[model samples]
Target: MVASLLILAVSGGMLWAVGLNYDGLTGGQAQKVHPASYLCVLLVLWQMLRRGNPVANLVSAAEHRPASCLLAAASIAMAAQIILRGASGTAGAIDTFLQAALVMILLLESDARSLRRLETLVHAVMAANAVLGIVEFATGQRFFPFRLDGATFETDTRSAALQGHPLGNATLTACYVLALIAGGGSLKPLTRLVMIAVQLVALVTFGGRSAIVVTLVLGGAFGLAQLLRAIARGRIPLLAAAGAACALPLVATTVAGLAYGGFFDALLGRFASDGGSANARVAMFDLFSRLPLRDLILGPDPSLVDSLRRITGLEWGIENPIIRVVLYQGALMALLLTTAVTLFLVEVGRRCRAGIAMPMIAFVVLINTFESLGGKTTLLAKFVIVLVALYRPFPETRIARAS
Candidate 1:
């Protein structure tokens, strides 16, 4: 289990070591494929072969149908980009999606105990990273300096967690919070409460406005639903209540210790004005108006896209995968992307309780509004790991509901 989790963490891009710098693999950190990505490919190939070779394994198993369909659909976009626009057409975004898909496939084969262990590993990593985030914010010292190209550019605006992207860290931290609170990882009552506080605080340090807003709204909805369900049942369990009460003081103590150490100055400042993120989003859509209709409908040459970026004075390329698919892969590929994502949702959701699953999906979609998971991200990979770790089969849940 330890070895498996180590592979999983490294492959998922969750490590904190300096060696994981991911240099040379690709110059741009956001578009690079780390050494860990190669590890994922090897592990996936091994898993497929063990299941009776790649082709037969994917096609023959009834349980594999969902993953098979999703992969097939998603591959269309990636394959289309390569076939039509050449190997240089895409940045590393689609590669991230493919790596995440492979992670999901490997996880589906894990037994229940291994899944639980995986969740524990994720929780440990989250907690460690949260503490590191807090320290970085408190001391105004980041372990990993921000790199602009090959040069080290330092910043105090936000804590750069292990993965070295504040926004991505914020997104994953938010997802981790939702997953834990919604029910997944094994946690003692007090530990759970404390981690929630730590993670939420770390979230502020990372200062992702979208993650903060979406998490708050969805979290409130989930809380209300849980309360309503408990009330309708006519009673809260005495043991559960007693345990929560017992854990309250510890949770309070934990909060009191951490609360004053790091302030939300950065978060508050960004909330006032999003550093032109809103303007940038608006400008992205304007690219369509400027593009030739033919290029817009049928993926433009990547070089043409860049020339247009200069023409339009936009600062970045695609931030959202939904938009990226249409602009980079064309309209037909967009349909395939949507179909693939929908299939992935269904597959992941069935392994979790409906209450938890719905909110988690909502969180992913909301976070994606600001950035693409199909880009250089392990959010999808980690999210799927959490889902399976907390796995409660759909039929089992239905049986319980009926009873």
Candidate 2:
């Protein structure tokens, strides 16, 4: 319990740390290590020493061996690229290594002995973020003064919560919501419904178009799955089905009205205007297209942001994780990374009783499509822990005893 709480604190703090600019600690770079990283490092060291045989413990987890090998291979590939490219590539390479290291450390140190404990820790983190988001949205003021910008900190319409960007907040909320849905069977029906409702409200308040769309799709899919399950069991009453069919049109009308209403109009107004966001992504792609074949096979120029700016005359970073990985670390490495993650997700989905893994996977993919969440080391660490927990074999004896 103590270890779980500490892990939760470090993870939750890092999410909130995104919005902060620690001048002395980070030197104004948002990517640099902050207080949370220091705490996490200390916890990892303590846990490693306490265990006495870190290597044996790591090796004992046979299920994680493949993931470990894949991570190592990806690291080597990135390191080789950096060495070939020299000084300019060093920073990016170091960033990637640091992110990977943090994730590995968190996964190794986590004391969650079962999937239930792991889910509880994750849910606690999500709940913290959800509460902060709700407060930020209602009050139009952040609970913490962690701004990416060094100057002029002010909160207005958007609910940034602990994440620096509103879009990031929304994306994180969407991910948590999907996770909850996937693990809903672990909780009572009322508890699950309440948690889902709270998260949905928080996601809507954060107002990211990607979040909104992904949440809607996943929620609809979950509903359909439930309906199908009931039908399969002959549990759904004919009268209930008939009532649902008759009310479908009214529900559709209400949703349409809400979409055109003031709140949703304000929430999604940005996408309706000039296609700036879409165009920027296209511009990034265009810039990548002009790179030399050698660069494409090995890696692009070290100064990816600068190269994009030079080509497109716009100062924007890559938004898509797939494109970002390919541009930074060759296509082969990107494929390896994607395959590793996809396989793990599939494995978890196969093990899940509620069939929530597919929706969670979709949520991750959709969120990454519009945001570079894969680049965030802290969040990535949390994801690694979640994957590890899901991969762990269930304690059959404990389940039988409980039953």
Candidate 3:
């Protein structure tokens, strides 16, 4: 029952998130934001309801075990932001909320009965997301209410719709596709085919080089892993089919590359553009270096956010979440956040032992390659996944009481 509600909350929140503007408020907050985000907050709290101490519940799973220096270092950096800057409190609140949700999931899923329900929820979300994405594409308007502007889904000027941010859309679509794959839920062949078609269309819409790169990297890795497993199992035909399938895409791309100059040119242009150059990041790195040593250890004051805006003519930095946290919060706070998340991921990975964790890691690593993951929404999503993957209640315990 709790898992069902959480799924509804997540679906509702994603719809709202896609619908809302970059500011994250719908209709000035006075007109009323969608109830989805608030619902997500409630779902997160459900983890701790009369459930005994959360920390104590996780104790058997060793969640509070002593963390490594790398982990410690990261959390300290995050803590520094909260203590010194006070800038990230709102975003941090979202992260904490997601963390709570994850804890609940881990606790709830420990039993067989709850695990089945969780699987159902995952598949349902995947189906819903795929349908919404397709409908939005077909209509050429935001699929959900109060849609926001980004690279893909545009609410701004005339040409903006045509040039919708490709990468962001692709990332969102691909994440759902991966979720379906990782969740291990059963689906009919036609439904699976439909999902692939929808995701492919979304991918083309995304048009970000980073998304393309991620697709290639992750696709290659998964293919290799599967092939190795097939070989070990002596599945000769499967190995042959896998090898042939992998070669086909590259071959098709190469053939298409020769026929279209714009395709190759645009691809290369993403790399050559000065504004997108790696040297741009170097400038930010230099700024980090010039700060006082203590700034790296703790963080700048919350007022520094305004200071940073005045200097950069932008609200936030790009390309590195770590750098963003350090600049916005402080070293200590960044460190704390990093440690908590790292530990959470490690714990969940050990418990599930599923390949699902690979794509989650890829999402983070890939985003950091092009843009910072320090945004409140981005961090919140990250923490939510951690919560979902980790939390599973004791079904036996719940059932016994009911019986």
Candidate 4:
């Protein structure tokens, strides 16, 4: 279980380092052989072969009857859709199937019962990425130390860290940071504050506007909850309250000082700019609206990009995961996907009965709007794992009984 946890953490955290894109390979081809998926498969296979008791593992997974059934149904539905529609391309189809397989294996093999172990795994991943980001910031080079020409760190303005893209690094870090905040009282105040500060700095340095927005919103929500809890507990004396109010400006000034010049302005400017990228996404939605109801329900023919290009005379892929799902996989599947995620969030809320999950869920939804997360199986797996860890048996029992 420890080995599995480490595999998930290291692979999911250092995605760019694991998944190398070689020269002469198309994007789809590179995705098909992503090192994270390959390593996961090997790990699963090694466990099965070494134990020689795949049946026992399957039975153990069945203990979580509802989750097991839901996973099985979702996997079948996804596989059937891909097999019937034949995916957008051969490489895409292969990648989808492989990723689907990996997710299934991870869900079945992972033992998330130990919340402490899981938390440690998560912190390890975050710490590794934070160190990598520091290294990349100090030296304008990739941290993986690979010799692949043209495959080195390419982004000049933003910190990619080990997650490949600036947005990917920022989004993933934001999620983990939110999770850490959600695991309230489990960490010391100073330690938690320092961890959040480190991740926030990395997020700001990455300069992903969407990620930045989501992180700030979620972090604010976490802070508000903490304040409310302190008030309810009678921990906030009048003197302390007045002191905090007086120090707010100093805190804000310190944050501003830490941010690079024009950091906040650039974030706002990205939102204000009516660049081709923004126009393309808006045009894609416009094209979606013009399509027939049948296409919306059954998905577009030829491909979303092709259909949009034909209609708007501009080539661009759907950036929103929800929109991409509805466009390519039909509204029904999209509905199912949304329902599953909603149910998971509802369950987390029911178990933990806290405000933490709410902010994290909102962050996930907001980030997915800007970038398609369908292909990011490792990230998704880590997310579900963290959610489960957050509301696992021990914490759930303690919190629920208190409530």
Candidate 5:
């Protein structure tokens, strides 16, 4: 039973990391629900039914009270909203939410040893996915059949990796890379460094300007902090630093050689010119201005929003989750979601190590800036996996409950 549980836990993490895109690979949303989604729902129920299981123990544990409660409430509210509102993308959103929620449950209930193994699985899959992203970028080939509503999802430079969407791939890769830097202790120092480099490049290839910029700001800030510590502790000598600085030309030469294939040219060009994505983000605010007071509270009709989109020339739909929540689900649901997310972070932060929790938290907050949680995205589920992988419970709290 223990062995089976371990396998289940690890497999669930792997499933989310690679996220096979089973539902939409060939064409439209062929299956209403993903196979992975069904497996996750079943896993949660199965674990709950089994006595003395981690799920059972966690429910009765003191430390898990806040997080577990929030998870339950949020899950219930999200499902109710989907059923009651029957919003445009509710079918995909609900499945993604449940899978993410249950994965958190599975992780929260596991023993520390199981978490260690799960962490390793997550790292491996993400690293492999980065490599796959590189291959797709180079070959201009999408491993999964890319079709959206019976039409080919075409792109010139960005890769459709396993995530199937360039922006989603960029966001997930950027966030996962950040999470690894935070708490992915399963990887060795060198392996971690390699992944950091590879996935950062993968971030560029995936072509999400927001993800790249956020990563740089946060990652650069973190790197600066580490550099300061090294200097203060005399771990890095002044002479050695100067020598390294002087070697910048050599480093540039090597980097240029690596970029010889021009894989990075497109992203670099995008940095120079965002093709109105920036304007769109700013212009999206105009949506709320046009909405009536009642529409702001109850959310305007989908057809109405569509007409507004056309008028606003936002043919691509709203990209910001902040605006998405209010415009799609109303302010009430938005408030509830914001409250739940805030509680989940606070509860997990105290339990997790500062290093891991801080980056993971930043990733979540920054990611929603560009990626909407209201859409057909596995982003939430993926974030939950990172949360549970690094979660560090109070041992004594669990012990007291067991006694």
Candidate 6:
């Protein structure tokens, strides 16, 4: 499990690095390295080959956890949309579903201790992403090595860092920080502090208000849940510490945002002017209400895309998730897709209630509302949900102190 995750993270990081300066390259060169997304898929197929029997192979290939299965269904629905529409996006996003399946298999195969190790692997990957984000923001350069550019970080907005999109980068950074919250890993103080600081930088640099909001809300929710759990267990000191760490990001971001020029004011400005981003999102929601039921249920035709272009008077795409899926997949697929995600959360919540893994299902569920789990964000969100549901984190390990 550790090996596979490491491979996936490294491969993703590499691909992301190349993408940062992608503007300079010819289109043909860009296509050359694009196939790297399938590296994790290859690893999963190899594991399937090792399993021997036919039934075992089929079951082995399926998502071992309920949450993963739902996420897998989501991946399929998305891929089907792409196939049906001939839309050009990242193929690796689809491959990420395959990666999720591999992680699920590994979860079913591992014991509790191994599960924690898997968590460690995920945590490491996220930490790496945070570090990469910091580098990108500071130097305006890509982190991963590309076909021609060597290992130097250089600034270029045309090619955001290796992650391709600012939102995707923020998602990777946020997901890891959330994992760090759940596990309460080493350098707890420092990790929490860095996560808070970096999250602010990420949100500001990318202008990804949704990702920032989701991170703040989820971080607060997880922290509160842990605090309550600790208090009930008579671990008051730990609870206090946990509360501080969890609340720090939201607190810091709110203060910083206020100092820089209040976010609330910006939101109001958006609504008032209808030219600010907040109002744009409101407009998208308004447009959704006006879309026909038939289009909403069966997915929008290319005509709707043209209509969006006309109405928005912008010759581009929509950034909102709910509307995007509703427009692309129609109502029926949207309903089933939503049902699958809801069921996964129910299962994860059930596990948390059973005192199995850390209580993070609620946090993930909240985060999913603002960011489409099916889109370009980190695949680890899917892995984290399923791993928590399937294997459960190990019972806390007690290391003996020197006598």
Better of 1 and 4 by TM-score: 1
lDDT (10s digit) by residue, model 5, range 106-166? 5556777877876766666667667877897788875643454334546345766656666
lDDT of 2 by residue, 1-403 (tens): 3433433344323434555433223444443444444554466566667779877645543344345445545655665765776623333333333343444434533443545687776666667767787787666676543344344245236665555456656665676667667664256755776777778867776777777777788768877899899989989888878877987897688668866665465566666862466776777677566777777766766576466666685443566777777777667767866775555445434433444564466557665756353354334444444444534433434434666
Model 5 scores worst on lDDT over the 10 consecutive residues at: 4-13
Model 3: residues >4 Å from true position, as ranges?
A: 1-88, 96-110, 134-139, 144-183, 188-194, 224-234, 237-280, 313-316, 370-372, 378-403
Q: What TM-score does model 2 achieve against the real structure?
A: 0.73
Q: Rate the local accuracy (lDDT) of all candidates.
A: 0.64, 0.57, 0.47, 0.57, 0.64, 0.51
lDDT of 6 by residue, 292-358 (tens): 8777777777566557756875332344555556766676766765676556555444433243233
lDDT at position 309, candidate 6 = 51
- Mark the 10 consecutive residues where model 3 has the least summed lDDT: 156-165
Task: Kindly report which residue pairs in candidate 4 clash with one another.
Answer: none
Cα error of candidate 5 at position 93, Å: 3.8
Q: Which ten residues in a row have the lowest lDDT in candidate 2?
A: 87-96
What residue runs in model 2 are displaced by over 4 Å at the alpha carbon?
1-31, 34-58, 61-63, 76-118, 144-146, 149-157, 183-185, 237-261, 310-314, 343-354, 384-403
Identify the runs in model 6 with alpha carbons over 4 angstroms from their true place.
1-37, 60-67, 70-74, 77-93, 96-98, 111-117, 140-162, 182-207, 210-275, 286-292, 313-316, 345-371, 374-403
Worst 10 residues of 6 by lDDT: 394-403
> Per-residue lDDT of 19-82 in model 4, one digit per residue for the tens?
5342113444544344544565676667767778988755644443344335445545755785
Cα lDDT over the full model 6 = 0.51
TM-score of each: 0.81, 0.73, 0.65, 0.73, 0.82, 0.63
Give the Å error, residue 401, model 5.
8.9
**Candidate 1 accuracy as TM-score:** 0.81
